[model samples]
Target: MKVLLTGATGFIGSKLLPVLTQEKYDVYTIGRSNLDYAKHTKLDLKDNFAIENLMQSLKPDICLNLAWFVKHKIYWNSDENLDCLSLSTKLMKEFYKNNPNGIFYGFGTFYQYLHDTHIGNNLYTKSKIKTYEILKDFASLSNYKTSWGFIHNVYGKGEPSEKIISYLITKLRNKEEVFVQNPFNKFDFINVVDIANQIFYAIKNNYIGDFDICYGTSFTTQEIAYMICDILNVSKDLIKINHQSDQKFEISSKPLDIYKNINIKDRLCEMIDNL
Candidate 1:
């Protein structure tokens, strides 16, 4: 099978690239530059013309779209939200027009159901929710088949951002004190490898429609810091954990419903050990 991957060098994409290769699929990756993947095409996805043009030339069998601007903290408005969706819609239309039979996997986030609420307090969350709504609605009526994968917090190696796990690991490595916010806020995190495996499964198995993939285990920030301390064989007391009441916005305490018959507890523990 021939596949087109967006954000192929991202945290999930980098890990996913090798998985596709191991499965022996002909993969074409789209991004700003080339990496260690099947074939590379440099095209800025933000430009509709460039995206459509590249899709026309490549004619990939399927497109796994995972490109998006991510930020740790931001508040987005309606116009900003729509703009992000517009880009996604244009990309989808271009891919569908070129490869009508190709499948499109729209990578979404856990903020689909939260907007204008405490959980939606974050601007990034609102934008992601808008993106999901747009894609889900388009997929329902679009001629080509499409699927939406609502992913939870992802953690693994090669993560581009100085994110939660990486940040904590970095501070711990330097033997520096790290202060975390919202210790009581329950957040769902999944291993990047497991998420990539699910996406690969969806592609190979011809999965269409919306699916939620999560680790099912909710860990607090303090707990995560403790895990890191344990992994580094350092005193947990050195890692100062303070609860930020202001940052403790309201959010769903429940975990995402995963359909896969896989256990992630041991895997999460192993990740902690990998530190």
Candidate 2:
């Protein structure tokens, strides 16, 4: 299989490429930076004509898009949201027009929920929600094969930001105190490797439509902190829970139904241990 991958240097994309290449698939990666993979291409997706040219040249069987502007903080704001839809829509339309049979994979955030009313009042969440809505709309109308993966907290090596698990591991390794906000609030987390594996499965198996890509376990930040502390044989007392300044968004109670297809919870701790 020939696959064109965007955001090839991202947390999920980085881990996914090695596995896809090892499976004997020709992986063509498009990114701002060059990387060693099945193939390399520098693509500025904002340019529709350029993207169309690349799609016509590569003639890939699949296009896995992961590129997006993201902020680390949950409550941060950005003016980029105004143009996010235009850029993504243009890229998708060009890809779909060029290769109508090619599989189009879209990445969405699990935090973007409609039923769950206890949502965060932040621009990041709003933008993710808007992007997800567009993806859903695209999947519904597009003739080509389309799939959207709503991902939760993904942590592993090469994490762009210092996630809770990364922060805990660092603090424990240093024998220093760790501070966290709302440790009691439960959140969904997934190992980046597992997420990558599932992406391959979804493509190979021809999974079509929207899917919740997650490990299907909700653990509190405090629980994760203790898990890391236990792994390092450190005192849990060193972990301190701090309160957020503005608001208290309730824990994510969105029940993702990935259990019917696959779940990566069993290997969660083992993966963390290896990290």
Candidate 3:
């Protein structure tokens, strides 16, 4: 089947690309930078006309959207969240217009399930919720076999350099003193590979609607810092662990589900060594 992938160069998308290709699904990627693969288009996803033109060209059987305004700490209140939502809506419409019975999968976030108090307080969360609702509503009325994957605290290869794991790796490699903040905030992190695997499993098994994409485990920032220290065989004394609230929030204290089939511990050495 022809598959159109948005955010193919991103943390999660990059991981999923190989999985899809290995499974032999005809894949087309979208990005501003030229992709290594031949079947890709570099254009503005916000441009409705561009989407129409591209959809007319590929007419994919499935569209997996992993793009969004995720600029680390800045995305929570960014106006770009609205733009992503708009782009997603346009893509869905164009996809349906081209292949009426095709599949359209998008990524949601754990923030969408946070207490109602966070709704008006976060544009990123609010925008994602809006997109999720739109997909569900459209799917109910049309033949778009859409699915929404809710994920949070993702880490792995190709992740942003500022991410916790990446940060620790860089600092430890440089022998710089690293500070562990939000010592009590237990965040569950899913590997990009695992997230990609889950997405494929959902599509292959015909799983529809919304579902949580959790690693089924959690570790505190301090714990994670030490994990890196151990992996690097560096002195933990070079790290400072503080109890102060880091203000970095996560979805919950424990995973909503315990899907620890893939261990982050097993993957860390390879990811760190490679990066």
- Which candidate has the highest TM-score of all? 3
Evaluate residue 190 in candidate 2 and report its C-alpha lDDT on the 0 to 100 scale. 73
Clashing residue pairs, backbone N/CA/C < 3 A, model 1: 74-123, 75-123, 76-123
Instruction: Specify the poorest-scoring 10-residue window by lDDT in model 2.
Output: 253-262
Better of 1 and 2 by lDDT: 1
The residue-by-residue lDDT of candidate 3 on 1-275, one tens digit each, is: 89999999887888889999999999999866677888888887777888899999899999999988787889889999999999989889899899988888889887676637433369888899899889889878865688888886788877778888899889987889998876766667777777888788877776777777877667778878888888888998878877564454545432323354657777778778789
lDDT of 1 by residue, 1-275 (tens): 88888788777888889999899998888887667643887766567888778878888888888866553343244344455567778878887888888888888877665554565666567667666677667766865688888887787766644678878877886788888877777677678888888788778888888776675566787777887777677777766667656544323433233334445445545665565
Candidate 3 displacement at residue 199 in angstroms: 1.9
User: Considering summed lDDT, which 10 consecutive residues are worst modelled in model 3?
Assistant: 249-258
Kindly list the per-residue Cα lDDT of model 2 for residues 138-210, writing each as its tens digit.
7568556788777777777666437677777777778999998876666667777777887887887888877
Q: List candidate 2 stretches off by more than 4 Å.
A: 71-76, 81-84, 114-119, 245-275
Clashes of each: 3, 0, 0
What is the C-alpha RMSD, rounded to one decimal, of candidate 1? Answer: 3.7
lDDT of 1: 0.72
lDDT of each candidate versus the true structure: 0.72, 0.71, 0.81
Q: What TM-score, over all chains together, does every model reach?
A: 0.80, 0.83, 0.85
